[model samples]
Target: MPKGKKKTESRGAGLEEYLEGTVFLDLWRDKMFLGQEFLTWLYLTSEKNNHFFELPGGDGVEAFFENRLTLSHGRGNNRRSVAITTTEEPRDPDWDEAYTAIGNNKRVIKGTLRVKAENREWRLTLPHDTLSPQGVKLSAVKDPAETDDLGKAGKFLDKIALTAELVSIVDELFSLFLSRRLSETWLTEDVPRLKEYLSSRT
Candidate 1:
């Protein structure tokens, strides 16, 4: 027998046994909770800290929940979901409906966000499960069609740079969240304060 085939068989020997339980389902559910916890923390920090953040690299950013926010709880057939939306130019941070849902133990799972760095801004919807930006809108770039053929390349590069910058900002923020979330201070200090903040709102 080929060496690779032998190794594959060795690795697969106990696969059937390991696949025969609820372990994988439990692990997946745990991961989903991490996403919910991260978004919940992000919302709490955004409100308490006035939507201002200092990145690990010393740059400042302002990110706020805007227009739409979705929160969810439970799993399978027991799952509950809520969406909060507004037409106000600057959404009221003290929106009662959002606070009521949070007070009821819902966690933010999807949200529309506005993030600003320097003078540039990005608007996007972020889903907790994938943590991927959706419907992204970046600061206006020069219209490629209006530019000379030579300048069109430059405009294209400009768009790419803006996209990259947005990704970098979001990645940094998520990294910051994970680091804090995994720390003991999260349960001891952060969560207690988070509860207090939520209570005051609702």
Candidate 2:
């Protein structure tokens, strides 16, 4: 087998395990509703501020939902993918439409994300199943002209490292969400507030 093919297959296998295994599906279980709450709350939170939030030991970043969202009701009802942006018209998609759907017991299953950290930016589509980032478009952190071959290799490695750090930031955000979700805070605070946020939407 070619070295590149082997590496590709190995990565594919790992992603498969991550997606289909008990770990991710356990979170996806209908009753838990962890994914839905996390996303809905995130959308609400970002709207109230400049979307500025910090990960532990990291400078703050501005992050927001990037149009695409998937919402589902248990079964029999067809799943929906929505583009929640102002520019996509004729469709005229807005929160009120989504709010109505989810109110009928639908839940958000996926969303694309945009994050700006300092001068660097990243765009990723996230499936709630594993919180693994997909279609990750990352900004270059180093100027190519400043580097020789070995230095270029090191800069490439640095980009990979930065990519991992950026994606892991989502996982940390998930952890923060999960902590709040599992607590009574979700019911006592977030749920009521989520209802208000939904109602207030256009």
> Best-fitting candidate, measured by TM-score?
1
**TM per candidate:** 0.79, 0.69
Q: List the residue pairs that clash in candidate 1.
A: none
lDDT by residue for model 2 over 1-202, one digit each (tens)?
Answer: 0011123554456766676655755555654456666776666666545577765445576777766666666644565455444445333335566667667666777777787766678888877665678888887455667544547778778667667766667766676677777787878887887777667763
lDDT by residue for model 1 (60-94), tens: 89988898999998887998999999999887878
What RMSD, rounded to one decimal, does every model reach? Answer: 9.1, 8.2
Each candidate's clash count: 0, 0
Query: For model 2, which pairs clash?
Result: none
Query: How far does residue 125 in candidate 2 sit from its true spot (Å)?
Result: 0.6
